[model samples]
Target: MEWDWNFVRQIMPALVEGVKITILASVLGSILAAIVGLAIALARRSPHRLVSRSVGWFAEFIRGTPLLVQLYFIFYVLPDIGILLPPLVAGVIGLGLHYGTYTAEVYRAGIDNVPRGQWEAAKACNLSARQTWTHVIIPQAIPPMIPALANYFISMFKETPLLSAITVLELMNQAKIVANTYYRYLEPITLVGAFFLAISLIAVVLLRWLEQRYGRMEP
Candidate 1:
């Protein structure tokens, strides 16, 4: 079938609305993942062997599994145990947790890259552990990690389409609905691809800027 401008116009509002949800999920999920990843990274570095090993093993399990399976468990399986979440909440949790394992590795590497002298200096100054991490380690660590974190955010944005499986009305799901309603696959599907491509390219440009701004400052 031929491309139809009128049909495109009709579907644009719905698709735009879907894009908002897609971006919201990605942003919130990224924030949650960063927090979770930082916690996991810190836990794995605990002085206690049991705490460290347990967190390490749990992170590995999350990393080893497929995100789709995780999403299904959160959305479908949880209610069986008397826990229930909205579709969007379940999707956000799934994305955050699945990616948090990977981000934990990024955090580990960033933290490790800090010069050992910095830790020694903090100790020499009699800085408490809290003061040392807050004033020295994380500030130095996070700048270099921004590009990697941004990369994951872009990846999470793309993965938002997977939320469709759980009935979250993200871009791909909205496109699918439009296509089904009109029995026209070309326009809505093509539009979805176009939107994703545009956003991803923009994100890439921003990531490059971040790398240039922060990467060279690394010691």
Candidate 2:
């Protein structure tokens, strides 16, 4: 089909809403992933063998499974057990949980890279465990993790379309709706690609800025 500027214009409004929801999902999901990942990383480092092994296995389980399957399980299966969530909430949780496993590795690696002396120093200083982590370890570990975590953020943003499976009106879903409804795939599909490309470029710029800003270890 020939490109239809008018049809593009008509769909712009819907696409705008899609962009908003997509951004919202990405932001919320990234925040949750960061928090969950840290928790998993720390738990997997517990002194108790049972706790550490169980948490490690759980993280591996999540990391090994496909994200789509997890999303389906959360959105569709959970409701069968008296747990119901809004589609956006379900999608955010799925994205966060699925990606959190991967981020957990980043967290673990970052923490490990902190020199053993740092931990020894914290102990020598009589710093509480929480204070050591909060005041010393995490601050230092996080700088190097920025690039990896930002990469995951972009990946999660790209996968926002998967949210459509649970009825999220993200950009791709909106595009699909427009295409299916009007029987014109060219304009809407192309628009979707263009929109994604634009956002991705912007995200790249932001990632670079973050890298420059926080991707360094202080002397």
The residue ranges of model 2 lying beyond 4 angstroms of the native Cα positions read: none
Supply the TM-score for candidate 2. 0.96
Q: Per-residue lDDT tens digits of candidate 1, residues 1-219?
A: 899999999999999999999999999999999999999999999999999999999999998988999999999999999999999999999999988998999999999999999999999999999999999999999899988988988998999999999999999999999999989999999999999999999999999999999877874
lDDT tens digits by residue: candidate 2, 22-79: 9999999999999999999999889999999998899889888888888999999999
TM-score of each: 0.98, 0.96
lDDT of each: 0.94, 0.92
- Cα error, residue 136 of model 2, in Å, equals 1.3
Model 1's alpha-carbon lDDT is: 0.94
Please give the distance, in angstroms, between residue 124's alpha carbon in candidate 2 and its true position after superposition.
1.0
